[model samples]
Target: MDTKSLLIDTATTLFQQKGYKSVGLTEILKACNVTKGALYHHFPNGKEELLITCLHGLNEVITTDIKAIFSRHLSTKDAILSMIDKLILNFEKNDTIIGYTFSSIVSEMATMSEPVRIACSALYENIQNLYHEKLLTEGYSNESASAIALLLTASIEGAIMLCITQNSATPLKTIATLLPSILEVNK
Candidate 1:
């Protein structure tokens, strides 16, 4: 890839593996094999700016994936069930769920930077909005769709964390098995 994209990808991977606080520009530059001057040329505002860019790119990619999943199925339940299955298969194969990396950022740096904080919050809302719209199309009440959207987002995030911590997809698998009842109209 190009230098700018290379820098961002390396920094993002380091941030995911280490954390924003633990990583420095020097480390990122070293990881990318780029110099400090080269980084500043692209990211004049430095590390926070780079991270904010990373977050924005992640938001677009992840929301697009979510939107695609929501659109690929006729029912909200089917879409979400497919998402859960994909989550399990992804974790099993790659040992990493890319979107789940956002949780680590929230835990490590939410209070440290305003722009970055807002970026993360927007990403989460975008995800909820996608689900909310999908559920609304299925004739769910506004309140139910809103609440279920939140539940789905939060539950999947939590399950991914559990999967990562336990080094197994069993938590997400369990969620997949139990999610159908929760998605019922009467629920």
Candidate 2:
């Protein structure tokens, strides 16, 4: 990979594992075997700018992957189940789900950094909007669809954090079992 791509990839892994503030530019440079000048050449504004770039790239990845997963199933209920299943698969494969989630980073930065806050908020809103649209298409009223979408989004994110914190898939499994009932969908 090129220097810029290598730097981003390295930083992404570090950020995922240790968070944004914990990882320094020097660490990223060391991992990538690049000089500070190289990093500056690619990212003029430094770590924050690179993080923003990473966030944007992560948003694109999430949007595309989620749409692809949900598109295969015609029914909203099926699509949601598919998504939950995919989440389970992802969690099972990687003990630490990095790029797929950045809630920790958002919580740490939201109050302090306006740009990061806006980017995180926009990413969440887009996902919620997508869920709302799917629910509406499935015959739910607008208000009910939006409420349910928000509930599902909140629940899933919480489940991910809980699962990671506890180092077990129990939270995910429990949530999956309750989701159909919570959404009032017969499965």
Candidate 3:
């Protein structure tokens, strides 16, 4: 990857491990092996700007992953289970999830920055829509699909936060068990 891409990747990883507020530009610089001048050149507005870009990029990456996973499975339950399984594996490998670290970053910085708040909201909306589309595909009504999508996104994000804080993947595993019931359709 190029300097800008490398910087965003490095910063995203750091922001995932520690929320945006806890990470420093110097650390990002060191991690990416790029100079502050290069970072400023790519993100003239600075760290917040870079973080917003990273957030947007992370959302797109997640949306892509969910879309692919959803397409691979005809059933919503299987798709979501596969997703959770993937999450569990990733969390086991990294101890901190890649794009999944998003919730805490948003919770930490949303009120402090309008751009960050907007980015986080957009990310949530996009993920919800992905689930909503899947539910609709599986014969759910629009209202039910919307509600379930909201519930799923909130539950998964909350579980990720708990897993991160508790230093264990039990919360995610527990949530995975509950998803099948949550995803059940009455239609």
Candidate 4:
């Protein structure tokens, strides 16, 4: 890829592997094989700006994937179950070292940088909104859709954390198996 994208990807990977506080611009440049000039040319404000950009990039990727999943599934339960499966597959494919990049950074930077915090918050809301829209398309009322979406988002995040902490995808699998019952509507 290009130098700017390389720097961002390298920085993001490092941040996810390590943390924003622990990663430095020099390390990012070294890992990316770019220079200070190249990094600054793209990220004028340096590491913090790069962090925000990386978070936005992650958000765009995830949001697009979620939207596509919703479109493909049509049914809310199908979409959620598919998402859980995909998440587990992705974690396994990446050896479980990769995860929501923003989550790792946001917890550390939330009190330090408003921009970083806002970016993280906006990403989460976008995810929730995607869930909400998909549930609406599945014919749920607005109130039920909103609540279910929020619960799904929270549960999925928690499941991911459990998968990471436990070093297994069982949590995600369990969630996938149990989630549909939660989404089921009685006639």
Error of 4 at 69 (Å): 1.3
TM-score for every candidate vs. truth? 0.93, 0.92, 0.96, 0.93
Tens-place lDDT digits, model 2, residues 146-187: 888898788878887887889877777787888788677522
Model 1 global lDDT (CA atoms, 0 to 1): 0.85
Candidate 3, residue 104: CA error in Å?
1.3
On a 0 to 1 TM-score scale, where does candidate 3 land against the true structure? 0.96
Q: Tens digits of per-residue lDDT for model 1 on 11-75?
A: 87888767788999989988889999999999999999999988888888888888898888999
What root-mean-square deviation over C-alphas does model 1 reach?
1.5
lDDT tens digits by residue: candidate 3, 1-187: 9999999888998898887888999999999988999999999999999999999899989999999999899998899889988988888998867677798888899999998999999999999999999999999999999999998899889988888888788988998898898777444
Candidate 1, position 90, lDDT: 83
Kindly indicate the candidate among 1 and 3 with the higher lDDT. Answer: 3
Please state every model's RMSD to the true fold in angstroms: 1.5, 2.0, 1.1, 1.7
Tell me the deviation in Å of residue 145 in model 2.
1.6
Give the lowest summed-lDDT range of ten residues in model 3: 178-187
Worst 10 residues of 1 by lDDT: 178-187
> What does candidate 2 score on TM?
0.92
